[model samples]
Target: MVLPLSKDVSGKGVNVDQGSLNIKEVIDLLNGDAWVRLVASGAEGTWSLRHLHAVIGSQPPAWPDHDWIYGDIALLRAKLSIDRLKDALVAEDCRRFSVGSIEVEVPEVGPQVGWRRRPSFEQHDRERLQKPTWDLRVSAAQTSQHQLNRSGYLVGRSCPSFPDLQYAFRAFFEGDFSLNGGMSLPSELMVIRVINDEGWIGPIHVTPTHIDVQVDGRDLLGASLELYSTDQRTTTDLNSPNTVTFELPGGLPDTNVWLWLKKDGRWLDYRALYRPWATPDQLEAAGVKIDLPVDPLSTIEALVSGGEGPQVEFKRSLPETKSKDRNPYKTIAAFATMEGGWIVFGVDRDELTVVGLEVDDINGERDRLANLIRARVNPTPPFEATPYVIDGKQIMVLRVDSGVSPPYGIAVDPDAKDRPEYFVRRGASTYPAWPADLREAVMSRQPPAGFPNGMGGLGGAFPG
Candidate 1:
């Protein structure tokens, strides 16, 4: 029932002001294959209840006997009305493209019945698996929803224009919520080409787990895709640390075929660009600007409040020397050997309370811990020990990156059985590194593909 102001001089897309317009105009435009962009605009001034009446008045008899105004053309609530038109037009066999939120009736009237309220689209098209829809989705997955405006975690090419092409879009929870942070990693990125709008509609933050491509009513499966960025881009491929090179078919940068780039690698501090779909104006090309994540404090707060998982753990104090099981070294060694993670200390594990400390004398404590780590472990892992105060309570946050050289263990006695050898953090606890884990740690040390310094290749011979 909504139509944005057309991009042309006469606003030929829809004639809202018409007192008695011919239906042929609608049919003729559809025949020419104009995109169905239902954005609400000033055309509302001229549009009365009649426009919706026209769409519903023509509903065929075989169509469900639902009232027009009460059913498909009910209160135009937010972005949902656009898709209501989509469903109706699709019934008439017209192809439609939709963006932003979709409107769906809960407990769809059929054998299978359930309700998934809010922004999730799954409830609407599970069995039908709506085809040929391209998703460039970005969701703000963590605990509290955040504005992508000037976010610290994401990088973009140009300053985002505004709400349309801007990053301050909202994302919601999918079932796979993180217990520690309660935020899910964003998985899908949906980019829409709109009409008369300054930029693309959306591709907000989402949980990192949902990754896929659906274009032209088709699902893209098992296709080889690659990410391209400048050397200055600070990109982290969350899926893995291994370098990935994409091999494309002959005609990219020139085809209408849709491309998808999920939030697998994060970039910041510069313009981020992805050329996935052809613009509605096919002759012209443009780079889509993406939104970034929230600031560090919010991220930390979410993680600390979340349940312990493979990536997070809490410690009452520093690692104990005599008590092999008492030290945090095992966990440190484990994180380095596996996917890098975060460790928070000075919190009472039993109550998860932050008890302030005077681990004062910063340099002294820093030196002591540094020396202790060097003396106690072999091939020390890459880490940074940051002791800071949160809520006026002294605590330390230890960050461990998966090591360049791993398999680090207790130095003195490498074969000790009581304390166990290399350790790894599983769901919520650290355990002796499994044999498979050990093998992977060794392989992680190998230089990625062409890098020669760690490979004992040519770079090693040219000493400083």
Candidate 2:
């Protein structure tokens, strides 16, 4: 039977820790039944324990002896000890009964006979019972043993923390066993607020890496804000922040990502989850978005101007044609050399304009370009190639997200024999990798998990 525990029974509410006479009265009510069920505040929320003893410390018998006896003798003896201590003082009761990896107490005992074990509480059984007490044998057939076993484990695990054990017990009960495997990372959700001259606003950032942001209440639409990333080049446009959602190519890594809010050109970085690291005004200012156009030229200007965004560098287009090289593989190599960046075809760096390239077919050209990048570049860069129409002219935008490794090596020509030359990104340009810096970059390229399985590329972590 599901016994209702105290729910605001007094003006001050029932204190589980405070020894009260009402708690003694509730125990006395259980004394008249066979296998009485009592719902009491346990270390981990409410717990239901069955009383199976026939008598309580020689108290006057309230029920007949036929009410008990169905299971093991050890289980029966355990209940008898509980029955003897019902009227005992709270301190004495806790000392004698609460021990080991579980917290249990005998507040009072009824005149009912003790059984081996009582069936667990259930919804159907809850309806049939008139009061809190019920016969255990009648309900035994309906109880699920699996759930009981899990409950037993919870009881054992939460014994130490007492009342504060609710969080841990609830986590297990709700099937949040991801931590059981020992590899899953613990995470929490949080809100950021940002405040600025425009007003206050807030935005939610999920598991950000490096950014400071907060919510701003004054700006309900989330317009006034400040956002910044530790990685200087990695900034967000208050007007046009890309809502990016992509897998890490595997499972999540152990590292943390931070996201920040930017408003009116000011930045405030905030940790998105767990506890709020910024003020309410800061969070309000951070969540707001300022609408603006996003174009390749604008993107380049932002990167070159040392504004917030990914670190980027532009290069002068090579004079050679795709047919002349069988594959403009050298051009691909050039980009890979410097931590990977976009190679905008038909745009000259020395003179920015659409100096087009001859293509036999767009599809075939795209395929060949993709293949060259995949095959020619050493430690192949992770990238995507897509054709975008600008000014009624087609431009291939190669988006590359390079590894932290530096001195991306390039083979001058496909047939080059010696070690390929290495390059690195320096400001808005690419330069040959310095010997010391190249070594450091190469060493840092190795992922925490280990080196790549093949091609010396790093492998991402995966869920076990």
lDDT of 1 by residue, 1-464 (tens): 11222333234433222121222222222211122212111132321111111111112112222111211112122222334433433233432222323332211111111111111111232211111121111222231322211223322233222222112121111112122332322222111211111111122121122212211111112222333333222222323212232233321223222222222121111111333532322211122222223344454566667756776778777664455453677777777777666677777666766664566665466566666666555577776677666787676666666676667665435344234367766788888877897886677645446544332222222111
Q: Which stretches of candidate 1 lie over 4 Å from their true place?
A: 1-296, 320-326, 412-420, 434-437, 440-464
TM-scores across all candidates? 0.34, 0.34
Count clashing residue pairs per candidate: 37, 70
Alpha-carbon lDDT, every model: 0.37, 0.35
Per-residue lDDT tens digits for candidate 2, residues 180-228, read: 4321111111000001122222344333232233333222243333222
CA shift of 382, model 2, Å: 4.0
Error of 2 at 295 (Å): 12
